[model samples]
Target chain A: MNAHHLRRGALFLWTALLLAFIFAPIVSTIIFSFNADRFPSLPWAGFSVRWYEAVFADATILRGLINSLIVAGATAIVASFLGFAAAYVDYRYRFLGKVVYTALIALPPAVPVVILGIAMLTFEGRLGLSGTLTGVAVGHIVLAVPFAMALVRMRLADLDPDIERAAWNLGATPWAAVSGVVIPFCLPAILASIFLTAAVSFDEFMIAWFVSGVNETLPVRVLAMLQGQVSPKINAIGAIVFVVSMSLVVIAQVLIGNRADRSSKRT
Target chain B: MAFWAIPPILWQFAFFVVPLGFLVAMTFWSVRSFRLTPDMTLANWMFILKAGFFRSAYIYTFKLALLTALIASLSAFPAAYTLAFRLQPRTRRFLIFMLVVPFFTSYPVRIYSTQIFFSPEGIINAMIAPLGLGPVSVLDTPTGTVVGYLVLTLPLVLLLQTFALMNTPRDLIEAAHNLGCGRFRTILTVIVPTARVGLVLAATFAFVLSFGDYVAPLYLGGSNPPTLSILIADQVKSGNNWPRASVVAVTMILTLIVVMTAMLALAYGGRKKGRG
Candidate 1:
């Protein structure tokens, strides 16, 4: 082959291998979830719905899932409300300590979650709120707020100020202008942020590990299970979680992408 | 607007900022058999400095963090390059989407899956069984820990790199190619130089994520003494050494700040150069 043809062939081969490496473990887990064998490894003992049936039968995994859903739902609601407010002020007012506020919001994700967990442990101890679901929710709020804020802030930056100005000029109050006009305009961004926040809170481990007392979230339960022993059932659990999380993220991406495209077209 | 801002500000202050300040303060307080005292002391910081075990833990953790960042970024580059430039636009989007799917899954679940793949009776051993490569012990080894890091951070690096690469002007690449440059030569000369900022940012993200990670090592790094994160946890939970934990916490925060600042400066410099 000529050099150009040879180069193209090499690129194709490399891309295929890269894709395989990325997807192998994922595909393997999915395959094992269907395997009838007790071991997670190969030589599939024929396909069966036994593991999925077993997962549903297990009270612990089901409870963990429900706990995660509640925490993630609560976190999304509280974080998005607070984040929207914070982003609005920062975007419009240019208040004192804006830089500091921005930095603090960004800091949690950057700091080690373990350290944050310990910090929360100490802080909650003083408040006598340690080892409570409230404490875990508080921790989730702290972590999820920054992500929510960043997402909303990006949307706010894209919005035209004239729309709000026009509402004000028409004798609308500031709250009326914002609530009636601005929020509706940024609805897609807000929705995306909620989904993203929920995913993050649901998946969070370290912070939940420290703060969760008698209440175990799905990830915390999974960690406990893995540490105690290797169970093929964990693979079944992992496969279900992977599919659910991936679907949520895909939905979030599609929403955000669609909004961007529409906005660009409008402009 | 002011009314709305008030509640979030108050909530954040109470829950976020105040907690961090309290943690710093708690470090100095005395702990006697798990009960904290109001009396302050410098003994905890001193203990961290003098204790050989903690000192070694800090060194080992730092080394692992550095190696994980370096290795993840290197492996990520090739895949990123392929997605960014080599693939058709439709195919590129599909690949990028596929890469990010892994990240949406729970972090602990991902680590648990990695354990299954690398454990003695796992798939890797199953694949090698016929070759007499009996039961390779991948989990619990430093190498295994690094593999876990790679599995966790690879998607992140890829996503960041793809974002960076998307911003590079197509015309610039075309210009270089028109000048008789080979594809690889064009990538090195035109693409790499332009995309270096993204690479650095991706590396920073990888470093910060891997360094701060406690979960992967906790599950996979069996028998390895606590990483710096685990050490910090130990002090707080088991040892009741809050002050020393504070010192370690402060050290880690400072290290991250330095690295993040350097990455930002590099990105800023690149943007300024591009504009010029």
Candidate 2:
């Protein structure tokens, strides 16, 4: 083979290995979810949905999943709204402390989630709000806000300010110019941020572990279950989470990619 | 106009900043048999510094973070390079999509899966066992923790590096190639140097994620010396030593800032060198 062919073969092999390494554990768990036995091991006695059925019947897991949804939902809404506003301000005004605001916006995710979780734990305790769903929501907001802000900021940075100014110059109110023009333009990015933040909040564990007092999210429950030997029920939950999360991410990517393509074409 | 910015700022201050300030303040306060006191002392800091266990945890955790960051960045380089240059656009997009799938899943679930993969009778051992390799105890070892960290952060590095590589001007690479540079030479001298900033940023992020990670070590690391995150959690949860935990938290935050700043500086320096 020529050198170019050798390079191509090597690249293909490397990519396959990388994908295998990334997906193997995930695929294994998915397979285990259908195993007849409880533990994750070889000799799949037979494919069974008993674990799925068991997961459905488990009240605690069900409750945890519901709680996770509620928390993630609330987190997404609050984070997107707040983050959108911050991004707007940062985009529109080159104010003093703008850099500070940007830094703070990027700070949470950069910090260890565990530290943030611990900080929230102690912080909530001072406010007499320890171990509440609201407390967990607050933590999720801190985690999700930065992401939302970053996403919206990227979208806003790409926006032509002249369009909004032109709208306002044509007798449109400032709010009308923003809502009727800018927001409509940025809708895909906003939607992407919402789904991305929701996925993030839903999958969050350490923060939930710390802030979730009496309330347990699905991840925390999974952690508890894992302390025992690997249960097939956990695998069932994993399969559902994996499928749902992957679907949402794919949808978000498509939306973002479409937005990018449109914007690039316009430019 | 001011209302939108003010409320969120105030909200973050009231909820996030104030609470964190209280936590930090509490760290300096005395802890008597699990109950906190208002008395101020440097005892927490002193205790953390003096304690051999805490010192070891700090060193070991930093070491693990560094190792994981190095491994993640090196492995991701070729993948990122190929995606940026070699792959067709359609295939690149699909690969990138697949790369981020792990991120969307719940953090605990991923760690749990890692545990399954590493466990004595888990899929990994089961596969190897048939080849007469016997069982390899991947779970609870430093190697297992490293593997878990690698799996978690590799995609991130790949994404960031790919973004950086894609953003590089194509003409620059073509110019180098036209000057009689070999393909690998073009990539090394022209592409990697330009991509160094993003690689550093990605590595820094990987480092921070691995360093601060508590859940992975908690679930997958068995009997091994705990990472600093685990140590901090143990202090808060089991030891109930809030002050000590605070000290650890402070150390971690400071270390993160220092590492991040250093990485950014290195990236900036590299950019200047490339320009020169």
Candidate 3:
């Protein structure tokens, strides 16, 4: 083959191998969840849903799932609202110390989860919010808000500032202009941020592990189970969490992707 | 506009800034009979710093984080280059989406499942046995820890690299080629220089994440040689040593701030031309 063919073939092979490496753990988790084997190994012991059934039957796991859902939902709403407000403020105004404000908003995700977790744990302990689901939700909201703000901010960057001004000039109040014009323009990003933040909160482990004492989220529960024993049931829990998290992320991606397409077409 | 900004700013101050302040303050406080009493003593910091294990863990964590960043940046480049330059737009987009998917998934699950590939009786050994490469032990070792870090970072590094490389000006590459530069030389002199900021930022991100990651080291490395995160968890779990844990956490935060500032300077500073 020519050098051109060789280069193309090498690139394709590299892509395939990289993808295999990326997905191996996730694929193995899903496969073992369905495998009837007590341990994760090769030579499949036939397919069975018994582990999944075990997951559903467990009281603690069920409670953890419910707790995760609640935390994720609450975190999504609160974080998205705050994130939208933050993004809108950035979009509509230029104030002194804007750089500090932007940097502070972007700082949480960059910090190690261990540090954030302990800080939350210590501070919440003083506030009497420690060991409560509300504490866990609060921690998650802090972590997820930056992500939500980033998404909304990107969308806001595409919006013309004059549209809100036009709405105000047409006798609409500032609040009305925001609700009628700005929010509608940012609706897709807001929805995407909601899902993305929900996924983030749902998959988060360290903060939940620190603050959700006796009210463990699914990921925290998974860790407890993992430390306790190498159970096949953990594989089942992993599969479920993977599905839920991926679904939320996928929904968010689809929304953002669709918005990008529309905006690209407009340009 | 300032009115809309107040709530989020207040929320960040109340939760993020205030909690971090508490962490820093707690490092100076002493724990008495499982109760934390506020004091302005540096005992917690001194105790941890004097402990040999803590010092070793810091060195080990720094080395491992650097190793992860290096390996992830190097290995991800080929795939990232392929995606950015070799693929059709639709295929590239699909691959990019696939990379993004893992970031939002359950990281604990991902780290746990990696055990299957690292164990002596695991898939990696099984695959290599046919080639007469005897079953090698990787699980619970530094090698395994690095693998776990890679699993966390490689995809992210690849995505960032791809985005950065995609932004490389096409005309610059063509101009290099027309000047009789070889393909590799073109990449080195043209593409690499142009995408230096994004590339450096991507590797810095890899370093930052690997430095702070808790799951990979704990699960895959078995916490044998504890990282700072593992040490923090141990301190917190053992007899309510929250003060000691805060000391470690604060050390970590300081390390991150220093490293991030240095990396950002490397990425954006030192150049008269505004590239980034």
Candidate 4:
């Protein structure tokens, strides 16, 4: 008993140390974003929110945020639509070459971001879509689709097949069956995936580097700032972006969990 | 069913397959006065093959990947093991959530944070200066880049290995203990062996992530030999040489395939040895 107690204490201590190592950078960044000093460093310099004011006042940064919104919004819509369609097909009907479809959909996230970025840029250039916000959207769609598909498939696979079949037997057409039964069944997962894809597209930088032309996304703008100087302003903007996206992810998870609970009760 | 697969197939083929094929083909083509000409030649491939700079960059990238994988897996083991075996389920879930939270920060932002932390006039230097210790230069060096890589990869390693360790059977460890094995011996012979496949998969993921990253090396790897990813990015962003960039991309892709195969073999091998 004593040995077990000693072992548990050591494990807890080690875990605490590792957790601290992981949080150090993030906690420092969030703290120093309010640093009164010009440089983002320690010594407990007096706190100020002046850097947040700077971020809000910057027009170029705001434009980049708008550009990011456009790309991420389009990505969320297109990726979720295509991903749900693919996942629905795989789940509802048995078919040949389904595994190939699964592999093709999941493979993009595995490919190197730089390679994917350049490839899309070249391909978009071929279609005369290069150097436009639309081109960036094109890359974002590809980048985000895999995640959307995986999420949709997971949700779709969990649904009871009898509900959809019952709808079909009640004189509903295939499309009608899906609209009535399947769409409602997978709505929460679809919504969650849309938000998740938006977060991913918003965070992406490499694809934006290669595919985007005149307009910079928020991350690209941050990269440009990084080239000249390291200031409290970078920390401020980074903290805001991090907080906003993390909240989106957490909120999406909460919403999805609630829907899942209600559905389980109904079932 | 066929109809369902068609749209996604067409979508992916148009956006992904065609572009990848185009990229590979471009490697064999030549450029004339900034224009891509479909003149098939081995000139670009030959150039990358012969360039000592590219050769060293490839080796250096592999080195970083290996080192990152080793460091992350070693450090992650205790944390993952603790979470899988020692903690209550609720506490374990909360800790896992906390580990994943940092990843929500943008990739470039996370890498950029390290820049401020390790600068010559930054926090580390300041702390050491007060102690009368000489200033340590970590920013822009390989060490800095490694630290950035660990910041991202370590948590991932922890999560992956925890899943693997949780899947391990508790009975095996108990059986070893019953067989008169000491605590350390049981852990060595039973627990570590059983966790090998999961551990290898976790390491493989870390290796691949660190290997292909361009943003980290571009921002954190100052004055270091440009990684293959940086070389690939430079070829297009600055050099306007798509074909040359494709050559590097092709090499990187091939390396990825080779590394994946090697890791999968190790996973299978580890499982067999553990069973034996």
Candidate 5:
């Protein structure tokens, strides 16, 4: 019994250490962002938000932030719409090429971002869409739609087909049944997908780097800044980016979590 | 259904499929005066296939990816086991949430921050300074890259493994214990086999992500030995060699197809019906 207790203690310690290792880098970045030190080192400099101020002062960084917001916002709305449509199709009908359709929808993310980036750069260059924010948004939508589909599909799996059918049998039009029943049922997932995909586009670097030439997204901007020099200002940018993405993700999780809890309770 | 499905299908075909197809076709085209021109030639393929640097980079990337996957799987198993079997559901759920939060954060920022722990005069070295260990260089090394890869993959692998382990029926484990199997023995002879698919998938995911990654290897490893993704970027940015970049991208896609197919086969192969 004593040996078993010791073993359990060791395992707990190991898990704790693992979590620490996972979080250390991000935590350090956040901590250092508030430090007034030029270099992140032993002697803690006085607390300051100068780096954050510098991030705001920089015109290029500001442009990158705006561009990222626009791309993420556009990508979120369109990807969610298309993702809902695709997911609803999967839920509502069975077709001859269903497997193939699913595979194709899921294929974009499996392809490496580098390959996808170059491919987008090549194809969009032809359409005169490369080097534009719209092009980056399009690329992000391709990457994010799969996730949106997956999320909405999960929620749909819990939905009884009979519920929608009963609505239709009660003289409701297909469109009305969809808008009144399916849409409301999937509202949480749709909203979650919006925030999640927006976060995805916000943090995505490689595709944006390839497609957004002059209109660099925040992540792409950060990469350029990192390659150029080691600046404490990066910590500020990192912290802000981290906060924005984290907030979006947390809101998404809460949205999904509430539905999950309610569903589990019902079952 | 057709109305809902056809639009996404068309969109994916136009944006995803056509672009990939165009990439393959472009590989056969040549670059003239820094401009991609319409021409059918194998010169790009020939050059890339024959280049010593390409061969070395390919081998290096493959080896690195394999190492990352192996290490990530092995390390994640213990933590996953604890989460699955030891922790209460509420605690486990919270821990899983912690693991997942990293995915939404900026990956580049994470890789960049890893430099703080690995760089000379960085956190680790500074912490060990009083022990006379002084500064040890880890940044700009393969080790740094591995650490970055772990940052990217470990949380994901742990989550996958935990979910897989959680789904293992409790009765089977209890039956093994009743049969006088030791904890380690039960894990080896029963739990491992039961969760084999998920475990393999977790490793495969680690491989896929690391293999195609550019930022971690570049930012953390300093591109001392350029990975394929790095090569593609260099080809594009420096030489405007879209054809050569296309060649590399095609090779990568082909490699991924082969790897994914083989992994899926391995995960499902020879399993009894209904076992998975």
Candidate 6:
């Protein structure tokens, strides 16, 4: 091959290597969860369903799983709804203090999560809100809301304002216009935000570690257990988390699929 | 319009801004007689700066973030470039989707697994053992932490730069080609210049994420030299030195601001040259 072809081949190789690097750990975590051996290592033992069964059998793991789901579900609903409202306002009405609005939305991602975690702990002490699902959910909403708003904002920008205007001109009430116009238009992105935020809340550990109190989320439990010893059981839990989040992404993708067409119709 | 903004603004102020303000204030106040006091002083900040361990932790954290960003951006560029320019559109979307799947999973879990694999008798060592490259453990090493951060931030940075490259108008690239530029020459001149600011933003983001991450360092960083995040957590959890922890947190945040400002300036400078 000439230099150009050779360069092309190297590029393909690099991409393949990156793909392997990205997928390997998760793939191994899932594949080895079914390992018959107690330890996660080479010399493939016979595949067994025992590990998946073990995850369900353990009470702490099961409870942690439930707690995680609760936090994630609550975060998705609360964050997405509030975020949609915020994003809609930002998109629709550009005001003089919009710079301040932009700065506030950008805060969570800019600050290190550890600071947020510890800050909330002390701050909650003052409010007497420390160590509860409500507190933890609020913390997650703080982290996730910006992202949710960003998503809905993108979708809203794509949607034709004329459609909403047309509805208003035809004698629709405010609620009626939202239900008949904005809801259908923003449905996919709103759903995407819900799943997306759910994924973030589900995987979140650092902030949740502080605010969670006695009830540990799944990631916290895994971290706590791993601090003591390495168990294939932890791997099993990790596998399940990987699978669940992957499914959530697929669901989000399905929701977001027709968005290009939505935008394409705008121009 | 004001009403539309009220709910989120109120929520952020009630939860986010107030807490952050408290954290900032906490940094100036020092403990007295083992009780939380309102005696505002820079003594906590002075103590943190003077301490050898805290200083080293800061250095290690910044170094590791830089290293991870370097690794991530270097690796991400090739993949992102290929995806943007080489692959068929259908294949490109599928690959991008595949790339994104890892990030949706639990990040800490992935780091923990990286730790597991880097252990002495870990799977990686076991595989390499027969090849006489036996027992390669990087667990707790600065290198190991970088590896963990690399995996965590790589996907994010890759997605970012891939979009950056995608957003670079194709006609500009064609124009460069028509001007007698070879493919590599075209990439160096046309593609990179257009994507410079975005690529810089992506790298800086990767750097920030890596530096702020306590999880990877907790597991992958060896017992002695912990990163800033790990050190801050230890101070808060074990030392109960909330004031000192706040100082450290403030320092890290400031350092992050400096790093970001520098990167943004660099990206902007490059953009000026591109425009010229």
lDDT of 2: 0.83
Q: Find the candidate with the highest DockQ and give its number.
A: 5
RMSD of each: 2.4, 2.0, 1.7, 2.2, 1.5, 1.9
Q: What is the per-residue lDDT of model 3 for residues A1-267, given as tens digits with 9 covering 90 to 100?
A: 599798779888987898899988888888899999887888889999999999999999999999999999999999999999999988888889998997787678988888899899889988999899999999999998899999999999999999888988999999999999999989999999999999999999999999988888899999887776678898889889888988988899889989999999999
Please give the interface root mean square deviation for model 4, in Å.
1.6
DockQ of 3: 0.78
Q: What are the runs in model 1 whose C-alpha is more than 4 Å off?
A: A1-7, B129-135, B223-225, B269-276
- For all candidates, state DockQ relative to the true structure: 0.62, 0.63, 0.78, 0.67, 0.79, 0.75
- Residue pairs with clashing backbones, model 3: none
If the candidates were sorted by their lDDT against the true structure, best first, what order would they fall in? 5, 3, 6, 4, 2, 1
Candidate 3 wrong stretches, greater than 4 Å: A1-4, B273-276
The pairs that clash in candidate 5 are: none
Model 4 ranges with Cα > 4 A deviation: A1-10, A259-267, B128-134, B269-276
How many residue pairs clash in each candidate at the backbone level? 1, 1, 0, 0, 0, 2
Give the candidate order by descending DockQ: 5, 3, 6, 4, 2, 1
Q: Report the Cα lDDT for candidate 1.
A: 0.79
Worst 10 residues of 2 chain B by lDDT: B3-12
Please list all clashing residue pairs in model 1, or write none if there are none: B27-B243
For chain B alone, what TM-score does every candidate structure achieve against the true structure?
0.90, 0.94, 0.96, 0.93, 0.96, 0.94
Best of the candidates, lDDT: 5
TM-score of each: 0.93, 0.95, 0.97, 0.94, 0.97, 0.95
lDDT of 5 by residue, A50-139 (tens): 999999999999999999999999999999998999999999998888999988987898888999999999999999999999999999
For each candidate, give the interface RMSD after superposing the true interface residues on Cα. 2.0, 1.7, 1.2, 1.6, 1.0, 1.3
In Å, residue B206's CA in model 3 sits off its true spot by 1.1
TM-score of 3: 0.97
Writing each residue's lDDT as its tens digit, candidate 3 over B1-276 gives 767888888888899999999899888999887788989998888999999998999999999999999999888888888999998999998889889878876788888788867777778888899999969887788888899999999888999999999999888888888899988888787787778888898899898898988888888888878899999988887758988888888888889889888988888786666543
